[model samples]
Target: MLIGVPAETMAGETRVAVTPETTKKLMAQGHSVRVQSGAGVAASVTDAAYQAAGADMTDAAGALGCDLVLKVRSPSALELTQMKPGAALVGMLNPFDAEGLQRLASARLTAFALEAAPRTTRAQSMDVLSSQANIAGYKAVIMAADRYQKFFPMLMTAAGTVKAARVVILGVGVAGLQAIATAKRLGAVIEASDVRPSVKEQVESLGAKFIDVPYETAEEKEAAEGVGGYARPMPQSWLDRQKLEVAKRVAQADVVISTALIPGRAAPVLITEEMVASMKPGSVIIDMAAGKGAVNADGSVGGNCPLTEADKTVVKHGVTLVGETNLAALVAADASALYARNVLDFLKLVLPKDAAGIEVPLDDDIVAACLMTQGGEIKKT
Candidate 1:
């Protein structure tokens, strides 16, 4: 099998799909690896590194034209043009992007969107969402600490004693839980809220207070239980109650990090403009859900906060809002390593080590869920 690693062309995408560590493993599996020159540059893996791992360094065309193409993101239209019709593509392709899937089908590519994989225990090693979100969660806290005017930990100095920063984390998922853990390490007083009630124990275990909004009905409880390890859309009544509870915490918080996102839906507005206004002047907010939230009339999308500007840091109501769309990319080296391993694990299900060609076993739930396009058609859709 010929495996190719192409440089990511998407803006702000710094991670690569394959690292030298993974390349060596692929070579051990009787695969010929071809990596585009500088494909791993952004992730700190040099051409010499790939060569040392027995990978052939090639140009974009040589890499993308291979039998199997590994990518950090979905290819652009121009990139798709460079690929062979029947070549297989693997990436964290957005499965919800109907237009993108249509384009892959049109290109006659055997596309696999890893994000669609199930959240079962067997799929944990290949879970790109969890791996990337873990990095994002850690970075969000570091970013907040850098931008925040006060110290996360209280200090007893010769001049005066400084109070510890109050940190509030919204969405207690992979990202939010990481934020709580990170913030706790920084000695901040942390509080986290999530639609899922099961995460409350996890939050408390991390030394963060769980902001609870009692479920009013059976429907609310079921929705709060969530589906497939992801949060479902809570009823409006619950959201309203949560908003009130969150607003109280937001008013006193020195740092707020929101990681709430329902798959395939606009990120719910957890922090409104009014909430921002009530926050302390020097408070910092890291909106991890940026660029996937509600669209404004001006055609701008926000995160958990409507005031958040994607990829931009701005001050609204004297509070600083940091809306970094790709927080995982900021920590490129580790992010690439984890993502590459995910790609490698996913390949085992399709590309057998003892066999020559790939196999799309639709009977396998993980493979079926990730199969975006196959045989000149969109399979998962």
Candidate 2:
């Protein structure tokens, strides 16, 4: 099989879907690898490095016209024109984008949106969300620390004492948990909240306080549990109670990192204007859910905070809001490396080790969930 790795064309996107290490493995497995010249340059992977690892450096059109194409973002209209029909494509294709899926289906491409994969034991290695979210969580805290005027740790000087920063994390998923752990390492007092009750132990294990908004009704309890390890939208009654609890913590917080999101849904408003107004003047907010989430009525990026402008940093209510959507892309090297490995793991399911053909197993849950488009139809699950 011929495999292509193309340069990402999304604004501010620096991640590549394939790296030299993974390229080498595929080349050794009787696969012909084609990479766009300088595809991995932003990630510090030189063209010569890819060549050394047995990849044929080619133009974007050349690479796109292959048996299989791997990318970080979905192809643009021009790119779609260059691809061969029936060719396979794998990437974090933003499955929520109905129009994008439709375009891909119209092109008759067999597409796999990796973000849609199940979070099961067998699919762990191929979990792109967890791998990338881990990086975003760590980077969010770093962004907060940079914007904050004071130190995270308390200091006792001969002149005076500097108090430790109070950090709050919303949506204690993989990213939220990492935010707590990262803030704790910086000597800040951390508090985290999530709809799911199971993560309380995970939060406590990391030495952070878990903000509990107990479910008042059975419906709230069921919704709070979430589905397939991803969060579900909560009832308004529960959300109102949560807001009350979080508002109290936000008032005194030095840093707030919001990671709350429901898959294929607009990001919930976790940090409201009122909450932002009450925070300290020098406090920082790193909204990791900025541009990647918030599917509006017209399908624009909405954020955890309604005031958050995607990919832009805003100073509101005398507080700093770091609404950077590409925190993982900021650390492009490792993020692409981990994502490339995840893609490689998923390939084992469809691409044969010894043969030259791609096989899509409909019986496999991972494959079925990821197969958004096949045979010119939107086969969304």
Candidate 3:
């Protein structure tokens, strides 16, 4: 099979879909791997390195025209024209975008969006969300600490004693848990909140206090249970109670990291403008779910915090909001390396081990869930 790795064209996106380590693995599996010239440049991988791994270096058109096209972001319209009919594409293509799916269908391309894979033990090895979210979570704390005026760890000086920074993490997903772990290592006092009551143990296990919002009604309890290990949208009553509980923490918090997100939905407004107003001056917030590709009336994508303006760092109510969306892109090398492994794992379902061809197993659950468009039809799993 001919596998192509194209350079990401999205502005400010530095990560590539494939890395040198995975390139050699694919070559050993009897596949011809071709990468666009300078595709891995941003990830600090050079053309020579890919060549050393036995990959042919080519141009954008040449790379996109392969039997299998790999990418970090979804292909743009111009890029679609470069691909051949009936070619297969695999990457983190945004499955939520109806228009993009239509384009892919029109092109008669068999497209796989890895983000749509189910969250099961069997699918864990190929879980792109967890791998990238882990990076986002770790980077969130680092970026928050860098932006804050005070140190994360408490200090004792001859002149005086410096108190440890208080941090509040919202949404206890893979990213939020990692954020807590990262902050704890930095010696910060941590408190976290999540709709699911089950995660309280996870928070306490990490030595952080869990801010619990009790379910007053059966509806709230049922909603909190969520699906596939993801939190469902809570009832307004619970949300109100949560806001009141979170407001108190926000006012006293020196740093805030919001990682809340529901798949296929706009990120819930966890941190409101009022919460930002009450936070301490010089505090920093890293919204990993910022600018989640939602265009606002003002023509800008909003972040988890109401005050956040996407992709920009601004001080609102004396609190700094870091609204960069591509947190995984910041750690490009590891992100690509991990993502490449996931792609390779997923390819095994379609490509046989012995030969240079693909036989996509459409009946497989993981493959079915990820098949956004096949044979010019948007399949519903």
Clash count, candidate 2: 0
Return whichever of 1 and 3 wins on TM-score: 1
Q: What digit string (tens of lDDT, one per residue) describes model 2 on residues 1-381?
A: 999998999988999999999998998888999999989999999999999999999999989999899999899999999999999999998898999999999999999999999989999999999999999999999989999999999999999999999999998999998889899999999999899999999999999999999888999999988888988988999989999999999998999999988887678888888999999899999988887655565665658987677888999999998889888998899999999999999999999777667799999999999999999999994
Clashing pairs in 1: none
> For each candidate, what TM-score against the reference?
0.99, 0.96, 0.97
Estimate, for each residue in 1-381, the C-alpha lDDT of model 3 and write its tens digit.
899999999998999988899999989988899999999998999999999999999999999999999998889999999999989999888888888889888898899999999999999988999999999999999999999999899999998999999999999999999999999999999999999999999999998999988889999999999999899999999999999999999899999999998888888888888888988889998888888735666787777886678789999889999998889999999888899899989988888787556577878999989998888888753
lDDT of 1 by residue, 1-381 (tens): 999999999999999999999999999999999999999999999999999999999999999999999999999999999999999999988999999999999999999999999999999999999999999999999999999988999899999999999999999999998999999999999999999889889999999999999999999999898889989998999989999999999999999999999899999999999999999898999999999999977899999999999999999999999999999999999999999999999999999868877899999999999999987898865
- TM-score, candidate number 3: 0.97
Candidate 1 clashes: the total is: 0
lDDT of 1 at 3: 91
Where does model 2 exceed 4 Å of error? 292-301
Stretches of model 1 off by over 4 angstroms after superposition? none
User: Which lDDT values do the candidates have, in the order given?
Assistant: 0.95, 0.92, 0.90
